[model samples]
Every structure is written in structure tokens, then in C-alpha cells.
Target: MKRIRFVLITLSMLLLAGCGLQNTPEFQPTLQDQISLYCLDHEGNLEMREESGRLQGYCVFTDGSECAEADFFNGVCKAGEIFGEASKRGEIGVLSADEAVEVEVNSGSVDADSGSDEIVLE
Candidate 1:
């Protein structure tokens, strides 16, 4: 009984440790992450949820881990929007720049803003 309990405890610890395992800094950019970017080239509304200057992209990982539906356009991140997390596969953005900056989303919502507001990360 003691051995079984010990094994179970060990397994639980390992699982929790694995879940918490993540790269340090969590602030640097990685290349392997999958990302999608969208830009507002023209001023037309197809009910595409047309917003201006918003970077739309996401970073996907091999293990099916990913940061999806992130937005970035210019040089500023909208409020309640985080770029990504270290624990995540990788951070991706829509309407993102050719290069992604190293940033971790500390808090906030990643939902698309109104048509009036543009999504840009500086």
C-alpha cells in the first residue's frame, strides 16, 4: 500500500511538473511557432469585421499548443491584450508585422476591437 501511494504521488508530481515546464525569459521570440497575419489593405467592409491597422496572427506548436487569435498592427498593443505566454507553444498574431517582438501577455482580452479601433503593437 505504501509503495502504491508513493508511485501515485510521484506520478502526480511529474504531471504537474510537466505542465509547469516552460522556457525561461518567456520574453524572447521563437521561429518554430506558426503564425497568421492579416492587414487592412483597403477600406471596404465585407462584414469581414473590417478594422484598420490591426495585426491578426497566431503561433501554433507541434503538440497542438498554440496562442491563437492575437492581434498586432503597428507599434502598440491594445489594452487587455497580451502578446503571448512562455508556457504557450508560441505567440502568434493576426495583422502582425513581418517580425514578431518578444513579449508575454501578462493580462487582458484578445478579442477583436470595434471597427473604429485599430490593433497595433509597439
Candidate 2:
């Protein structure tokens, strides 16, 4: 009887130990961690969110436009566009001048009697 009780107790303890091991904490990265990793791997600033253990967000431009939607799972960006219209705009200049030119324009006078609001550019 003593040996049977000892064996049963030992088996129960072993089963409990196995259960504890199964419940060990998993190394799941948070939204910020995923974003940091994404930024390091990719270019530009990206905003991220975590949903059902997956990270999702959009790469935003300086003008506050949605460049692309990024979806990351297990710390990997599975789908998204890195650069969009904003990046293209950055590459292309709006105005190009061969040489610097000086021009003067009226900045509006504070006093009606005095015309001293003229701004001179050099």
C-alpha cells in the first residue's frame, strides 16, 4: 500500500510540473517593440497597433496622409508599402531655380500715412 501511494503521488507531481511548463510565458513583442523593429528595418516613421497578437498601422507622411497600411505578425511586417505619394513628393522638387534672385514685395503697412512695410529680399 505504501509503494502504491508513493507512486501515485510522484506521478501527480510530475503531471503538475508538466502543466506548469506548458503555461510558461511566451515571448510576445508589444506594439512599440514591433514598431521599433519595423522602423529599424524600414524607412520613415510608422504608427502601429496590436490586434489579436498582430501589429497593424500606417506609414504617415509629414503632411499627415496615410502612405500605406502595415500589418505585422510575430514581429514581421507581412504586408504594407514603405513609401507612397509623400515620399515621391519629397524626391521631386516643387520649385527649382537656376540662380537666386532678389525681389521686393509690399508686406502691408501698419500705419496708412507711412509706407515703411515694404520688405526687401536680397
Q: What are the C-alpha RMSDs, in order, of all predicted structures?
A: 21.0, 13.6
TM-score, cand. 1 vs. native:
0.21
Candidate 2 Cα errors over 4 Å, as ranges:
23-58, 64-122
Cand. 1 Cα-lDDT = 0.40
Error of 1 at 101 (Å): 43
Model 1 per-residue lDDT at 48: 28
lDDT accuracy of residue 117 in candidate 1 = 32
List model 1 lDDT by residue over 44-114, tens digit each.
11122223475435433333322333322332333233444421233344322344466575555433655
The lDDT leader among the candidates is 2
Return the TM-score for each candidate structure. 0.21, 0.31
Cα lDDT tens digits for candidate 2, 1-122: 99999999999999999888766698999876775566446544677667559766655544433333333223222223233333433542222223344546646335545665333333
